[model samples]
Target: MENINIKQSDGAASLAKVYAIANQKGGVGKTTTALTLGEALTREGKKVLVIDLDPHANASVHMSYFPETVTTSAHDLFFDDADFKSLWGKIVKKREWVGFDFVPASIRLSELEVDLKDRKNKGMVLSNSLDEVKEYYDYILIDCPPHVGVLLVNAIVAADIVLIPIQTDFLALYGIRLLFDTIKILNKVLPSPVKFRALPTMYDGRAGACRKILNLIRRKLGDKVFSTVIHMDTKFREACASGRIIFDVDPKTRGAQEYMQLAREIVRNENA
Candidate 1:
């Protein structure tokens, strides 16, 4: 497999490609996509780091770290005035998901929205924090929360791409427009070369409604919709319950296969 050519500037290290998995709708499989896709990328020999920005920390739990037990979390990195690198090193946790690492989230992150209310340049905190360590990985995936808040803004400001995971349901479709509107407003401010795409998740081909929604999304979004769709599978929930990724629970499952295909598409598109 060919690796992506990292572009450096002025002798500074090339930063990792940051992809923020976000959707204003809940139960859209954001955490699942972030974790599974990161693992798939790791399987391809690329260094990947998944940052759980959601206070729920479902990705952290999937990585075998309970939210309550995590000491130094992404929350600490944002609020604490300690050494950035030291805090980062301490917060980042190594996972058995092929060689990928992740910075777990704590419930305390839920308080950030109100905590940073009047702070100057609060939107750029996540971006500034990531700049220090982005060179260490080839890709960084951020699992954002299900609502529009300071955390989501920080993730968007820091990301090079926004990967929206929308479930193949009518309710999930309702929030797509709102999410894009938010991104549009954010783009005006940050002005970074951030790309956006929609990925259909929790897809069940047998369900007529699922097929219709998928087709509708493709027709409306065109090339912005990923060709690979994450099919609905019970193994996904089982893996979460077992505190493991789909590949670890059953590599041959449709869930694993779809995520691997999604990872390949991401690599092909980004590296092209």
Candidate 2:
């Protein structure tokens, strides 16, 4: 399987953390962050595996080939297996974006919850699968489903850390609290604990609601919030549509630079 491996020097994998880029609210740049941040990590020469866990397949859409596609997706990994060896082989090397491999999301994933929700040890499925082939990469990022469902639970159950992208608005803070409550529930259910940090996304500093929401998030979540706030940038979505990451599209753009800084911040904090 030809995969995207970083050629530069990104510090060796310190924690072996599986970070799930998650959000219950749509349009908060969850998939955008996953795609671009993975690219940024690759730029620094770190291996990254992105698992598109959503049935909507938004992450796959952003990162993978759209029209002419293959079938090795979340559904195939979890439900299908005539032979597990070929599963990892399906990971295509993204020539356009360096340093990342993707487990694409299938349309059949929409049927997963209704199909496998009641199965035995349901939450462990994706985690167990990753454990089987985790040595192929350093960082694993699961792009979770938009709601609190079986898919979300499975991702949360497996994550070492979670990066939540929250919009800067009034109701956004309330929704994020609900997401944290979900995390607490999953923490109690899983044997190993998971850590989390919230990032303010789609921010407009001129808006009072943006300031209010940030204050509320800081007051409630405190230091768990990421120091970098991602301001509104249309180029990011345009980059996705153009079949590339923000940094690849325009490295000098504020949004692209902020995401790069976010990656460095996370890497720096691992030792602290």
Candidate 3:
């Protein structure tokens, strides 16, 4: 884990690796993982960028961003002539339990699809824009919109990796396969070369249904899934409401402990 923080020149400040934290379906803790992991990565001394593509601006709101005040959003990136490089300058450096920085999403992002549909390179707009600022952070986590559209294609095109957060519920059981199929089609048709893995969130071991979902997911995905599970905890809510990472809010809490473990797993996977 220390080795990952040593800065091996994989290009945290010079080259950015875009990771799309996506799932077409909603309520999967997608934003939660983005905030917590970004926080953990920052704590490990890695610069992290979070892009909010969801119109709800949940990530932005969770980060204490007031949509009324934010003029530029992901919508502007796709429409406005302002160089996307300038977008990097708009980054609102957050004060979090972890020291990582983030670029917030605005409520106006919902206008992205309708705004970019007429453009020729609409699907690749995000990727082209990110090229100008890819070198500033080690990780660029994009929180995708929860539906299939031009916005989603843009996100898929921009990502080198996709981390899907699957909820431990019966509803999520079928959605996983559907999401994978969508990814496959995107790779085949949209031609976005992206790799992906599943990370179970809001895990509850006490529930028999939860255990069933976990076992089924592991049985199918094998080691592609993360080893550390994010358990349901009160501290997570407190941290999210406060725009702080779980560990920053309460290092001894269940949510905080699992996130730290998840951070180590991320490093290990990168090393392997």
lDDT of 3 by residue, 16-70 (tens): 6777888877888888888888777767666777788888888878776667876
Clash count per candidate: 0, 0, 3
How accurate locally is residue 43 in candidate 2, as Cα lDDT from 0 to 100?
73
lDDT of 2 at 26: 82
Cα lDDT of model 3 overall? 0.75
**Would you list the clashing residue pairs of candidate 1?**
none
Which lDDT values do the candidates have, in the order given?
A: 0.85, 0.76, 0.75
TM-score of each: 0.92, 0.89, 0.88
Tens-place lDDT digits, model 2, residues 1-272: 34434332345444346898888888788888888788877776667877788877777776654423744566777774455555556643455555677777777777777888678988787777666556556678888887887888888877878889998887676667678889888778777777888989988899898888888888888998999889998888778778777776789998989888888888778648
Model 1 spans > 4 angstroms off = 1-13
Ranking by lDDT: 1, 2, 3
lDDT of 1 by residue, 60-154 (tens): 87777788777778898678655776667677777544467788889999999889999999999999888877877889999999888899999
Poorest 10 consecutive residues of model 2 by lDDT? Answer: 1-10
lDDT of 3 at 194: 62
